[model samples]
Target chain A: MMKYYYDLMSQPSRACYIFLKKNKIPFTPCPLRITKGEHRSEEYTKINPFQLVPAIEHNGFNLTESVAILRYLCREFPHVGEEWYPSDSKIQARIDEYMEWQHLNTRMQLAMYFQTKFIIPKMTGTEPDMKTVERSQDRMETILDQFEEIWLDNRPYVAGDKITVADIVAICELEQPSMAGYDVTEGRPKLAEYMKRVKKHLQPEYDEAFEQVYRVRGRFWGGENAPHSKL
Target chain B: MMKYYYDLMSQPSRACYIFLKKNKIPFTPCPLRITKGEHRSEEYTKINPFQLVPAIEHNGFNLTESVAILRYLCREFPHVGEEWYPSDSKIQARIDEYMEWQHLNTRMQLAMYFQTKFIIPKMTGTEPDMKTVERSQDRMETILDQFEEIWLDNRPYVAGDKITVADIVAICELEQPSMAGYDVTEGRPKLAEYMKRVKKHLQPEYDEAFEQVYRVRGRFWGGENAPHSKL
Candidate 1:
């Protein structure tokens, strides 16, 4: 039996969760709450020395990093839909290009913006640094523009017409800024439409994973249950 | 004909160059001098929208990002040795894991340190900022520790006993800081031995690609012929 360890709030964790759920890959869900430092426990360290979320164990083979896990699953289980990873070398290369590029670009910038705006502030009990926040926002803006002009470029999805794990990983990372009350899709129609398509394609799983994220957002950003909520 | 665009100065570019030469993969080399701003030329944008070094064009297909390019080459040329990428799903996953983890941790920190200590100072005609340089060095130290403790914990190679692309990519990234006069392998015996093995395995091509890099290092850092050299 495969065992997956993750927390929904972490972007890569959310990505893995959504991928596993959508693909219906059977595995034990081992959810770790990063907010409480559960990921740093000595026991979990044995599973993933990095102590990062979205790790898995199958037949005693442990793995970390979402990209590796996704690729491993696709290869290990041939039943994983071809549309998600695809078998064609060229098309798969396009998807691989996005996946590799996103680590330093899309994922890094958005996560930085979100962390500077919300997580850091909350953890430190201090206001966010305006200069650092603005710089990250600028970077995030540039990355979003690239997504629109370079990756999307009027295509229905990131790699091509069909949604791949690259799209899944991207959308999860993009969603991080929302918790900080930043709407990344506000000025970019291409990105906005692409996000909608990705969301619709993932269906209940998308909404399911994001529900926990948005609830945390609601409590922190005063969306609905601000007064009574305690995350 | 497959066209590979790269600059030996860039780590990923050197990795791709070495891989191609070592594997005997036929490619038309399109070397671009990043220092000359050749990569950012309008003509190059058609090949890679990001105007980045280490891209490839093959069969009317364009791909950027080193990891993608390497994987594509492995798949496209089935004759390429399996040890580089490994057809076995588990070993491949291990290679993929290191490849993915290095982007943000190993590559980012080492590149940040190199840029802060050497590249930025050269471009601006100013001394390196000690504070930022120290911070990046600290981060680089942590990443190196992880490399030794987590990845290379007794394994002859990064993924396993056999040399893989992951080791190639890692060694190239690790070499960047040397230009800034940082000896990353100084305190780590395992890393030093691992580096030696990777170099020996790749042989003359490793020495070939690095000759240009070492030349650049010597020119700036006062090696032989420093007075007359202009990079």
Candidate 2:
């Protein structure tokens, strides 16, 4: 049995969890309360020195890094093949390119925006800096333009027709911003349609996983619901 | 021949160049003068949207992101074999884990250090902030301690006894700070020995590739030599 440590609200952890469930892989879920700083504990550090969520421990082997864990899952489980991770070298390479590029591009832009604008400000009880938030939004806008022009260009997915792990990795980040009421695909028809397709592919599972994501939605929307640390 | 666009002084470019040469894979080196702003040209952006050096074009398929390019070449070439990228699933996963982890930890700390200390300050005509540089160094020190204690714990190579692409990627980044005269392995005997082994394995090929690396070494050491934009 493999021990998976993750939080439902964390994007990468959600991605890993969704992938495991989608593939029907048998594993024990070891949820970590990241907002509570449980991940920083010595017990969790032994599992992952970096103390980030979404680490895996199988027997004696321990692994961290979401992409690597997803890659490992795809290779380790026989059920997950072409559709989950295309066997074609060119397609795999395209997926690889997006995964690498996203770390600095989509992941940073979205995560930083949420952190600076929402998470940090809320946690610290400080006012959110609109200037900094706008800068983060501005950077995301540039990458979104590239995403439409280059990545999702007329294809059904980032790589090609079939949905690969790249789409899973990307959508997770792209949707994270929506938690703060910034629906990215709102203005662009092409991107809006693409988002629809992504949601359709992962549907019930996606909705189930991101339920906690939207729990934070009311925080920025100025509703009665107060944002929990996790929210 | 597959066209590999690179600048020798760039660490990622050097790693890709050396890997191609070592594997006896045929590739035409298409050098891009990054310091001259050639990479940002409209013509180059058509090939790589991010306007960065170390891109590749295989026939009509254009690719960016050095790690992805390396992964593609390893898959595309037969002569490279499992030793370059292990055949065992678990071993390959470990390498994948390292490659992914390095981007945020090892790569970020080192790159931020150089950018904040040398490149940005030089371009802006301002004194480098020792405070920020020390912060970057502090972060690197923590990771270096982890590198010795965790990754390189008595192992001959990063993953195990055999050298994988991860070593090439790491060694290239590890050597970059030397130009600015930060010998990371100075007091750490284990890491210093590990670096020696890495250099020895790569041998004459490593020395030849890093020729321009040492050429720029004089720049930060306060010698008479002027630092080129490429440096």
Candidate 3:
């Protein structure tokens, strides 16, 4: 049996988790308490030298990096539908385009948001630099604008009408800033509606997995839910 | 016939160019002169709204980003061998692992090197800041150390004994700092040897494509050859 090593709070981990559940790929969920620095332990290091969450081990093979893992899952479970990753040359290329672009754009922008809202404050015991945070927010907005004007552009989802791995990868990262209370959908009505549609398309099992993870963090729909957890 | 829009000096463009030549994928080369701002022009904007180079148009379908183009070529020209992108799930996963990790580690670090050596001097209208340049160099060293300690180890290439798309993508970016006279491989003999092996594995036609571009810049092998043409 394959094993999934993840921390539910992690954006990438959630994407992988949702993907696995959506496909019904059975695997042992080995949850890592990232807040406790378990990811840095020698045990985890033996699995992934990079010490990042969202890794997997299967049949004596270990792999790290969310995109890589997702690609592997798609290959292993082709029945997830060609829409998850189109076999057509042109559509697949579009999927690759989003995957490549998002690393520097969506992924980096979300990391910036996380560092400002979470990591920096945790490390220094001080509020994040507002100037830097605002800059990151602005950059993220620009990317979203591009996404709407180019990639989405009235389409049902990224890549095409049917959902694909590109949407799964992107929506998870886009939701990160929202979790930090940034509310990226503020000025972007099209993106807000798009998000609603995506959530609707996601399998119930996958949606439940996301809800289960978020409920533990005491957040609903990625924002303040009145009473915050003391833990 | 497909048309390729690229600027040879750009890292992603170089990767696409190498892949095309290596696999004998014929296409019309439409050079976008980045230094002259050709890529930002309205003509190029219509082709790729992001205005980035390495965009391609084949059979009326337009595509941007090198990774997308590489994968497209892999599908269109499957004769390039499964080794470039193995059919085996585990091997392909390993290739994907390096591709994702290198984005931040290798690509970002090299960008820092380019910024310190090229962009800073132009912006300040004086000699570059040695402190900033040294900092970038240190970061590159750290990244290279990880490349050796984790990714490379005793393997002949990044993905394994066979040179895959991962190695091609990585080496093109790694070669950028070398073009600026920073021989990153100087201290790491193993990396230097591996680079030599990769260069040898690249088809002569593809090697010539790079040779033609780098020779004009007079920075083919770093050091004395790396004289700034504009200077």
Maximum-TM-score candidate? 1
Share of native C-alpha contacts between chains A and B (below 8 angstroms) recovered by candidate 3? 0.91
Evaluated on CA atoms against the true complex, candidate 1 attains a DockQ of 0.91
DockQ for candidate 2: 0.73
RMSD per prediction, one decimal?
3.7, 3.8, 3.9
Chain A TM-scores for all candidates read: 0.94, 0.93, 0.88
- Candidate numbers sorted by DockQ from highest down: 1, 3, 2
Encode model 1's per-residue lDDT on A99-188: one tens digit a residue.
999999999999999999888999999999999999999999999999899998868988888889999999999888888888777778
Fraction of native contacts (fnat) of each candidate:
0.98, 0.69, 0.91
Q: Tens-digit lDDT track for model 2 on B1-231?
A: 788888997888999888988887888888988889889889888889778879999988998888888888878885685778877888888888888888777777777787777777888999989998889888888887887788897687888888999999988988777766677776777877788888888877898889888766764664543332222
Candidate 3, residue A158: how far the Cα is off, in Å: 0.6
Per-model TM values vs. the true structure: 0.95, 0.93, 0.91
Clashing pairs in 2: none
Scored against the true structure, residue B177 in model 3 reaches a CA lDDT of 77
User: First chain of model 2: TM-score?
Assistant: 0.93
Q: Model 2, stretches more than 4 Å misplaced?
A: A222-231, B222-231
Most DockQ-accurate candidate: 1
lDDT scores in order: 0.89, 0.82, 0.79
